[model samples]
Target: MPDAAPPPAATPLAPVPRLDAAALVAALRAHTGEEFELVGPLPGGQVGAALVRRPGRREEVLTHWGGASDATWARVARTGALLERARDAGIPAPRYALVARLPERIAVVQERLPGEPPTRVDLALVQEMVAIAGRGAGLLRERRDVPAAELHLLRSGPGFCLHESLAQYDERTRRLLDLVRRIGTGHASRMAGDDLVHLDFHPGNVLVDRTGTVTGVIDWDSVGRGDHRFALVTLRFDLAVPGTGAADRSARAAATRWLDNRIDDLFGASPDGAATLRAYWAHMGLRQVDWAIRHHGPDDVDRWLTVAAARLA
Candidate 1:
């Protein structure tokens, strides 16, 4: 008998196109029927932003929310609606003018708020932003809207803490994960609230003027209903990440102290505040460590683990 023919190999999936400045500019021009001059790229985590100047219009930011599944896009739509509510409440957020849902990517054109991200984050400005966020939270509390399944705390989605990534780390990190797992058991209940939370409330997402006034709090893609205090803890960890530049490092140190003071104040306000803070800390720690494991190298994981350990202690 003749030898059986070899089976065909599976076809490889095509790589997704990079959402660079040129690509974004083209996409914007195509979707909006307007010409755009690329200004520069803005810092982002899950998404990418570009500053573009349209003819006879103020500078606008075009955010490329990269390709996502339909479910994820649904969540983004809900988040956009929530942000609209927040903006109506006078929160410093952008106005979404156009949202283009394409086959391979999503692009949003937003009104560019004035001021730049502070080279050195001022704690006073951070506090003001947090207060504004709290008011937005209050608005969310009145509306009994539930986010999509993917936006839930326990969902194994991007930015949500998952346990599988812990296996990629060292012994010390594993030990920390043990504590985190224990603390996370009833965390959903503890964190349950109607307040809208910015899951990534870091300094980079906050825009400030020359006088250190927070002009806008950008990046509301991960906005959802949760305990507002959870965001405060996320900001604490964000301020502690080691930066590559001298100014950033100095800012991190000062901001860390400021966050520490804020945490202390929270603890002093209520007897159970410590436990609540610890739970939120574990959630933030897991979120950071898991994110580092996937997107960064061992050194980054170690740096985040150090922050996690300090919080656990």
Candidate 2:
């Protein structure tokens, strides 16, 4: 058995696909003439992945995805090439060893990059993460092939960034949903510009070494082109989450505020900055809240509501 990838790029995720290591192993063998064995479950991704080893040589990360349209998967297949550009700009991303597109799913085998998931989140970590986000600014400005990142506030996205959860939660959430919907409809349906948007940019998706330097940014399943500042907003919401790290609640709040201040420092001079921030903020709010409502219990949802209230209220 193996873990699945992120859900589709269209409609609701009903009967989704799963990852089969044997099928991928077969696919890789057929495509690249490689022999690999499933190692273990790789932790710390919204979509699950597994470690696959090429004995006596090196290891690779294996991911299997489905439900996205062929066009979407085609765009996804191009991400590995996009990584080359990211690497050129000094960003640490992995290279795809192979891509096996089967009738039911897409299997990807990529060269494994270094570092383990960061065990804790601190101010230094925050700064480094924000720096990582900054490194991606305008990286894709010239690449017209990549699609714009959808805000997903006005409606549900493929399988994540849902909007209906907030609408059903309660009066408070419904009001917040209204704000998010207003922003979603008022702003462009998709994010503008050509920056490299790690649609799920957060500490969890980042891998780091012992000294706390980020070695690689993993999980580009939903990667797209958009304003890099949107990533900071996503990071902001993640920091505001209860156990994302930094010792305690107050410290997490401080780290989030510090990040916001950094955004202000960079964007306070630009007229569109606040507006851009708010739109992204509302989108992330809907994403987190919707996921919490559907997956976690009431308290978890409540915590996210507090986070949303900071900006949406």
Candidate 3:
């Protein structure tokens, strides 16, 4: 017999604890009746969790504790339902399946979309996203008669508030919160459509393939009915330079232009719209800062405070 080629090098997978790993394998096998082999840890995101995949399954499965809440679990359910509805409506979305929802853990089996991370945001993709978002908003706005509890924003509200300020918080955070309080209770101007806005639309949240085509947008945790301009503003908030980079200033300018154009084109929102968005940003960002200070250490508290202050400014 011809000699088989040497086995491909094994990837240095991040170690999952022996007990937890065994439990996860058992749970998946029980649910899918197929043994799951460990793949690797998922990319770091705000939500603390790990993921594993099967040898040849089309769906990747995640193991998480925070998402198992009564409210969050429902949101995930609604997300899957919305994606399905969108697909039938000729909207692009990944296939999703809910595998297990245990008392302490939640897992969702989802089809991996075809795309790699994009190198930069292409303007065409931006327009496409806005169009899809517009359609989604229209759908949500039409259904506003639905119970408020069924709304995505209400569920996400408890999750989006700013964290408490820790002792080590920097000066910048103070400025940010002060600005937020100043924003007061202003209402966002009603746009033409009110469907669904992927409130957390950002470059990193979008996926694209090598050809630079957007495959599908992920991270539905923030999907809900709200001002379309809120979505626009969140996408624009990254204008602040991170550390020091050559194009930091240019990036901010481009982001500002993008925000202005999107707001004008999609919503016909005016200068007052900008203030409303900023106020919301300060308020929500401070909520996050508060949560961080309460949960994290000195470094995180300081960083959040500084960013919060900068946002207010």
TM per candidate comes to 0.80, 0.86, 0.69
RMSD of 3: 11.7
Candidate 2 global TM-score: 0.86
Candidate 2: list runs displaced more than 4 Å: 1-34, 243-254
Per-residue lDDT of 29 in model 2: 68
Residue 303 deviation, candidate 1, in Å?
2.2
Candidate 1 lDDT over residue span 1-313, tens digit each = 1222232243212223335878767876877787788988766544467788877998888876667678767766777788788778777888887687766778777888888887676557667766776775565656675551122224334434655566435555556678876766655533556777777888788888888888888888777776676777878888776677887677667767876887788665987787777777777777777766666556667777878878686
In terms of TM-score, how similar is model 1 to the real structure? 0.80
lDDT agreement with native, every candidate: 0.69, 0.75, 0.53
Over the full model, what C-alpha lDDT does candidate 2 score relative to the true structure? 0.75
lDDT (10s digit) by residue, model 3, range 1-313 = 1222232243211222222544665676676776666555445345532356666665363544344678767767777776776666555666665457755666666665667555555455555555665556456655663222212111123444432241124445444554554554343322224556565666566677776677777666555655555555555554332424555445556656676676655444465655654555564465445555445444544555555555455
lDDT of 1 at 313: 67
| Per-residue lDDT of model 2, residues 70-179, tens digit only | 87577767788788888888778888987777666677878888999887777778898888777788888788988898888778887666665565556666677888
